[model samples]
Target: MAMQDLDPSEFKTQAPDAHGQVSTLKELGDEMKAKLARLGLMIAEEAGAGTYLQRDQTTSLCSTRSKGVEVLPIRQALQRYDWLKDYSWVAVKADTDKFTRDAASAPPDVVQGYFVRGLKGQVERAPVQTCLYVESRSTKQVVHNIVIAEEGSEINIITGCLAHGGIGRAMHEGISEFYVKKGAKVTFTMIHEWQEQMEVRPRTAIVLDEGAAFINNYIALKPVGSIQSNPIAYLNGDNSRVMFQTILYGKGSSRMDLGSRAVLKGRNTSAEMVSRIITRDKADVVARGLIVGDAPGAKGHLECRGLLLSDTSRIDSIPELDAKNPDVNITHEAAVGKISPDEINYLMARGATEDEATSMIINGFLSFDLSELPPEIAKETKKLVDQTMKGL
Candidate 1:
C-alpha cells in the first residue's frame, strides 16, 4: 500500500487496549518491556544511563525510572508538574489550563511543556528516551514539548524516540519549541527507531536571545515506511548562534525527506547546518536546508550531502541561502553521490572482506567526532552508528 503525505501538526488521539478496553499499568507485563527493549536497545547494563518513558497504548507518559531528571505524564505536567526541590540550579512548572485557554479556538491534541532555569553558569543534563507501542493498525501518536533556558544558564538534553509492535502499524508526530534566553546555551540531540511499517514526522521551532546559543543533533537509522520534516530556527538577538546537524539512513522502500533552516536576524549572529544521508535497498531520500542572513553582521552556512549504496536507490541534496543585507554573508553547498569504490578497495586490500570494507567506509561517512559529549550519550550514538550498515 502506498503511504500518503502526513501532517506533523495533527494526529489521532489515544485509544484503549488492543481489545478495545481500558487497561492499567499493572496489566502491561514485564514481557512487553522486554519486547520493546529489543527495538529500543534498552538493555540491563544501560538501565541507569537516563530516564525511560514507555508508552504502551496511550498519550500519557509512563515513567520507568530516572537518574537526575523528573518524569511526568503530559496530562500530569499540564496540571501538576514541578522541578526538583533539591536541585537549586533550575526552576520548573507547567499549566495546561492556560495553554488550553490560549489555544481555545483550535487547541492541540497533545500539549506538553516544561520550564527550565540554569543556575548562574552551571550546566545540567536532561536526557530522555520515549517508546510508542501500537495495538491497532495505523495508530497515530502526537506529542509537543516546550523548553526554556534562563539567562546565564546552560543545559543539555538528549532524546531517543522509538516504536515497535508484533502486529499493527504506527505513526508519530512530534512538535518541539525552544527558547534560549540571553547569555544561556542549550544543546539537544534526538534519535529515532521504528518498525519497517511505521511513519514519523517531527516539527521544531527555536528562538535565541542576545548572546544565546542552541546546538541541535538529529539521527534516524531504523526502518520506517515514510518520514518527513523540516525544523526552523530564528537567531533574533545580537551575538546569538545556532548549529544544526543531522544523520539519516533509509532502508527498505522507505521515502524520507529531512532538513533544517536557520535565520540570522540579529547583528553578529551566526548559524551553521550540516546533514548526511545514507540510502540503501529501494529507499529514496532528499536532504534539504536553508540559511538566511538578514542583519548587517550576520553570517551563516548550509551544507547537505547524501550517499547512495544501491543503484536501485535514489538520493538528492538541496541547499539554499538568502542574504538581505550587503554586509551579511550566507552560503550553501549540496552534493549527492554513491560511495567511492577506490576507498572500499583500499580497505579490502588491508585484510578486510568486501562486506567489512563497505561497512568501514559507510561508518567513516556517518561518523561525527564529538569529544565534549557525555560518556553515555557518546556510547549510545556510537552503538547506533555502528549498527547502521550492519546486516545489509
Candidate 2:
C-alpha cells in the first residue's frame, strides 16, 4: 500500500487490560501517524527542494536531487494522533520469534537487496535527518534499518519511543544499522520512555569507513520496568573516529542494562564513551563501556558514573579497555555513590524543601556533561528526569 493510503487511525487499537488502569498504546500510535502527516504537509507547503524533500513511501527514483541538508520531524507526525496509554499482556515466545526473524532477514537486504529495491543513491556531502516512533502491545518486536553513504556526507537522526500508558508484561526489540562511507559523518540521538511494566531491548550497530566519524547520544528515563540497550560501533578505515554518550535514570522497580562498545581496526582511529546513571527505590542499573584498540595508532577512552539514591538501589559499572598496539592510548574511569548530605544540607538551608533540593542536585548530575545535545531535547530530558525523581 502507498504510504499516504495508510491511515494512522487504522493502526491504532485499544490496548488490553493491565493492572487496573487503561494503557496508552493506541493513543500513542494515532499521535505518531498524525505527526508524520503534518510533517509531510509542512515540507510540501515550504516548497524548498535543496533544503528538504518529504517523501513517505511514494516518490519514485530521482537522482537529480542536490546534496543539501535534510530534516525529518517524527514527533510532529506522531502528535497528529491521540496518545495511547495502556497495553495488554503478550506471550514471550511470540515476541522472541519475531525478533529472530527480522534479524535473519537483515543481512540479505543489506548485501544485495539494496540494488534490487531501487534504493536511493548516497546523499554525498549533505546532512539528512530522520525520526521514528513505535507503539506496540502484547509482545511485539520492531526492526528498523538505516544507511548513509558517500564521501563527505553528514546525517543527523533522532528517534523517540514511548509507551501509551501502563503495560502488563511485554517485550519490544529494535535493531538499526548505519553504514558511513569514507569521509562521512553521522550523528544519532535516541530517546526512550516506557510505562511501568514494559520491557524494552534496543540494539544498534554502525560501521565507519576511512576518515569517517560517528557520534551517538542516548537517553533513557523509565522509572519502572526493565530496559536493555546495546550500542556498538566499528572503525574499519584509517583516521576514523567514534564517540558515544549515554544517560539513564531508573526508579521504583525499573532495571536497566545499558552500554556501548567500540572496536578500532585501522590506523589513527579513535573512540570515546561517556555515560551516567541514576537509581532510586528498589531499582537496579548495570552500565558498561568498552573500547578495544587492536591496530597501531588507534586510541580509545571510556568514563562512567552512577548515583544510588536509596539503600536498596543498585548500580554497577564495568569499563573495559583492551589495547594490543603499544602505540595506542586507552583510558577508563568509573564511580558509584549517593548524593552528599553536605550538598543537600546546603540547599535545604537556603529555604528549599528536602525533596526539591534532592531533585535539583540529581538533575544537575545528569545534565552536567550533556552540553553537546540540542537545547530543546536536553531541556525535555531534564524535565522528564525531574518528574521521575519526584515519584521516588
Write down the TM-score of every candidate.
0.78, 0.68
TM-score of 2: 0.68
Each model's lDDT comes to: 0.64, 0.57
Summarize candidate 1's per-residue lDDT along 127-175 as a digit string, tens digits: 3444444444555655555566677766666666666555345676555
The Cα error of candidate 1 at residue 8, in Å, is 8.6
Which parts of model 2 are misplaced by more than 4 Å? 1-102, 105-136, 345-357, 368-392
Best by TM-score: 1
Error of 2 at 142 (Å): 2.1
